[model samples]
Target: MNAPARIADFVINSNADDLAQQITLLAGQINAATHRLLKLIAEFDTCKGWSGGGTVRTCAHWLNWQCGIALGAAREKVRVAHRLEELPLIDAAFEKGEISYSKVRAMTRVATAENEDYLLMIARHGTASHMEKLVGKFDRVQRQRTDRQHDKEQENARKLVYYQNDDGMWVIHAKLPPEAGEQVIKALEAVVAPIQEERQRELQESCSTDAHGDVSAETFSATVEHEKRESGNHFQELLEHTRADALVKITEHFLATSAGGTSLQALKGAERCQIMLHVDIDTLQRNGSTHAPNPHCREFEHQQWLSPDTARRLSCDASLVTLCRYHHRLLHQGSFSIEAVRDEGHDSPALRFISAAGATIETSFFPQFPGVSAETSPLALQRLAPDVDATTSCPYWTGEHMDYGMAVDGLLRRTQ
Candidate 1:
């Protein structure tokens, strides 16, 4: 650790002269941000209820809820308010009315911390006319290397991966349209039901004929040959000849012990029509890896306060937000969200949230797993959100020079 840094942490925590302004700014900024963000959180959860909590409607409903004006006016209000959440000193400055409504919106929406900070500083210290000048400077600074990365990510996400296979089949490997699910279920039922019924009838007739007056083996063989020689046969018919247990075993063998040459892209887009469901904060962070394990996934969701289990729980049937195999880690240590659903106080913690198109999903914070719940009182679970941190002084550097000191780097390490 550097000498100045070790001392700076001390000063920052204690309000030494150089850090006095920064400490004041940090605390006030955090407070101001808390109110605005809390409103956003409430709005998000509220829209979750009122908007049927789908992807599109939650955002639209939230915009409507925030504005309380006409739809167009409310949109503008939401746009402005969300933009203001980006400003460096926005909450505190807005609280004090140092900047006008229009200026706050313009300044906050510029899309970079550095530019926002610089422009906010200039406007605070410069004339009203200086807003344009500050914005211009901010733009120029943003085109530099650092600011370009976020723009690149957004652009990359837009460029989806889509292609067609050799069989003249369409492949949309990304998130599937949730709209087609019912048709799919109906189609599957149509295809499978007759075969299943046929299997039951054949099994019954074979046993019945053998039970009293036996049918000749020649007749049974003739029926089998006729089925095998039928003009059109789908895999489902062949599957009926094999019992469900045998089908499962054979399919597993076909997949796992298949020729190594297979790329297995058939599994890629099949889960797309399934929905992504989730529980609220208390359950999300404590659960597994189905949600945001990386930055991009995190941002597309809430980005903040997301846990892998929470994300995975939400994306249970989702092909788009595919959770890795080891996603069960979200509940390894016993998370609070899993408990809250079972709390005696909760009348019915289980809920079904539907999308705008009427795609319904059943979600329960309290899953029916055998050993887990509020009743079980599992290990080391923090039920309420962790307390707002009181400031603490680290003494890692006091003993001697060290690499990176005791300050943790990386989000995973910090969380773990």
Candidate 2:
């Protein structure tokens, strides 16, 4: 019989009270042997290419084909074996059967020369799962530190730039701090709320009407309930349309009010918005001399660029207000405002521009004229009339009407 058959026969026939103890010793011996075998594999792999026997490309590949081991297991063994060379303490523990290969593998991932001693102690006393958890926590902390550093770099690089495209459309590019970006997103969503609700109501009404134009309340109710249930799934869809609408609202608000010389305080309760513009005193007088060549002549809201003519128009009646930052350690002068909007659950509220005296200046500033689109051109304001009536107009209007031109002229005089 072969030596293997002899050992099998001996193992089967042997009967003693110490058999279990002997099996335990055998297990330790096998573990120690495995440590030595891995070291030899590592050395053979390192020198394989020089011998022209490296057709398998890698030691792990050779092991997979020659020993019939799974590629994943072979690769893991190769990795651990190579790492063990740099981890003398861990290699010693493995060779002495004080720690299993599973524990060693997890340790080597996050272990460095500085922490290897502490990690080896843990591997000797703790279970494999415990070792794995420690490694995971270490990796997470390291990643967080790296992320904070990256965010700081990004904040330092934050900027806003604008230029006119070939088609005469203004293009704006902005980089903002994470918190500031979040605030802007929230503000945009708030502005888009009524528009979204109006669209939803129209959709429900259309669904409720049949071919004969007879409305069904039951169908409308069902549609409303269904929409509410699926609203979360449609956040991405709503955000896209809402973003476009918000941009239009912002541009219209700035051009209509700021260009016409309205003060920040005057727009209070009308809309919660702010804009900054930089213009030279010379430019505002429409002098033939130009500062367009100097970059300092044009910067708005810290990042946007304005053409000299546009800057001149906006600065006509601009006033400076002091702003506090960083716990009052710094103070600077600029135009800004804080305004509040009335909250009406499930109902679209009317939008009105209000003055400091709490009188409404313009009603339905967003929807504008009946035939005019929300995306109307800035120049279109000359042709379209304001949507003012008894129901839509503010209580302060009192039957007298102010056209866009008259309103702009009034704002200019008030600011001056």
Candidate 3:
């Protein structure tokens, strides 16, 4: 919201009554609306907005301005609406407004199209808890589909084979399957796009001394990719969007750096600068030098293990892999990897700390106070950890030390 808030601490401190009331109100609202939509759409064979014109071409037009979504997004919504009417159970739930409209839309995609039976069972006799279990099952199935598609592309990718016509038109051929033909094209383009971007960056840099020349993937697709898939080309279009999302992510990494950078469209078969990471010391070791104080990725590991927002930010493609790597390396040794995964008691996100070595002990960086600050007030790290506490000397910290490190001016820093 509003271009993601610059990283901030969580400052919520609501009472139990407030939390319960908020949840109940939301639940009631969703149930009421979900029921109304299902009842309205189920009884009618065709929506007033839609008729048998069935242009297949007609769907894309609706997606843009009117629907406020992409062409693919609009068609998928229509497809789900159509499928909902086909089933009595989901349609009935829709009529009851037991779930939100958006939930129904997501369920349509995630719920296996091939397995109508699973949806039917839930529709007939299932609670919200049951639906959640079903959603997990759907997610697992979708993950499997994604995996198979990846492997198929890898094995099916081909080597180049060319044919020269008498008129001097040379046609290049590749061995990849129909599903991976786009991927093949993508691989070849990756090599070409960066070269062109470099030329542009150099040209722009030469034009002005003050200007930070940006040579991103936008120019590559514009100058190099002359042909793009049309509306009906669902699978291919989705694949390309996925690729674009990835490229955008790479470009965002340089935002943290002073140097203006480029995002080259350098995607090959199953190669998209992707990394599978977890909360562990091993991850930090790979990026950081051995002599570095904290060679482990304890901070990243803890964020992944403890906080959802930090984990999401770290996992995003938009966050450059390079920056994340650098961030990992900067953290102190043994200090980074999160070991206490199973959270035992209620925890606050005031000040999170990472130990350089020991696992059992975690120092609470945020000091607690009766008045502290208003729930909405900005926190001052200095107040949490004062420079010289009542005890004149700095506390000697150890693995067994219960006291978190001292507070520096408006910040939490190591004691000593």
Candidate 4:
């Protein structure tokens, strides 16, 4: 049918379902046409049709100017066009109108000949949003793995060296990871920036003429002092001298505070930043194998999984909070009961765990030294473990011993 006749008929007779079907059919046709257009663009790019003796920088630039496509979208089209030439399966799917341009665009970003079939399968089954999310996650995983490897290399290469040169001047050189280097730079700038600004203001003020159209006596004196200071190799020497003085001040402050001479509140730039890690107890204690699912370590901030060794290194100077997987599983499986307790003598509420056999476990907190809770008496301890006498004193064993090893082995031995 002719274009006008089909439109007139559609306007007169179309129902909702018919309109939906026609829209779907037209979308398919548009996709097929777009596939052909991309094919032409690829061929044109190969022939350097838009190069025009280097007048145009790229085919995407030409498209943006002549075809009125947005520059970013034009670049994406060009990239997808070139990529499709290499992936025959995706190219055929695009030509057959089985997938839209959006899916092709996303797949081409992370696709290779080895993975093209898998990507095509996903494009066939998943929506554009799914494809976008999959691509994003894949990029993040790849980037994180790369970053971890790079960080390890940087850490191994870190060092600080100092020596006295032949001129009796102390020289220092340091190599640090990005985060540490940034902290050092910030500390130096924090100390030096104000001094630099003050110097700049003095220079501006001393050079300015007074309101009476002549330099004031104070200004002239200040200018003469400034000139005397700037007599030879002025700007660079002054800057280096100021930085050296700031460095000395910073070192003195650090030594004073570290030696307990005076306790100054931490400066904003000197505050420590903590990295949160989620790791299983077994992995943390034993440096267990990462291949095991139960002992895996993950970084909370970046959502990246880390190796056991890295987790241990991070935990060296860190405050630890542990959750045992085995105990958690047992708790979930109805092996124990936990409840909040707030007695008349207690200052704060605490969690109490009771075994299935009605034996109360230790309380979460012990404010004062009632070594063992009244609920868990020596008789109850003997009832739980008949082999060991509850009255026997062990140096490492105490009612208030909250260490993980003691809790897991000594205190919870009866439960196991």
For model 4, residues 1-416, the per-residue Cα lDDT tens digits are 89999998777676765766655555555566677789889999999887543335689987875566788899999999999989999998777666778888998987777677776766676667666777766655545668886688688879999987778798988999999999888888899999988985776565877664566678766775777676757777887888888887787777546644556644334234546677644445444446344422222333456677888888877766433655666677676767877655445455667776666754322223235453534354334333332211112222342233332232123322
Task: Find the number of clashing residue pairs for candidate 3.
Answer: 21
Candidate 2 lands at a TM-score of 0.35
Q: Estimate TM-scores for all models.
A: 0.25, 0.35, 0.27, 0.37
Candidate 1: count the clashes. Answer: 10
Clashes of each: 10, 0, 21, 0
On residues 126-225, what C-alpha lDDT tens digit does candidate 1 reach at each position? 4444455444454444445365664564444453356767775645444323335455445455555666678756844764465564566677667656
Provide the RMSD of all predictions against the true structure, rounded to 1 decimal: 26.4, 34.2, 30.9, 32.6
**Where is model 4 more than 4 Å wrong at Cα?**
1-14, 148-192, 195-416
lDDT of 4 at 83: 93
What is the C-alpha lDDT profile of model 2 across 151-242, one tens digit per residue? 77668878898997878787878889898888877878877888878876777667755665555678777876777678966856766767
Better of 2 and 4 by lDDT: 4
- Residue-wise C-alpha lDDT for candidate 3, range 359-384, written one tens digit per residue: 33233222224345534211232232
Which 10-residue span in candidate 2 carries the lowest summed lDDT? 386-395
- Cα lDDT of candidate 3 equals 0.43
Best by lDDT: 4
Off by over 4 Å in 3: 1-23, 38-73, 110-416
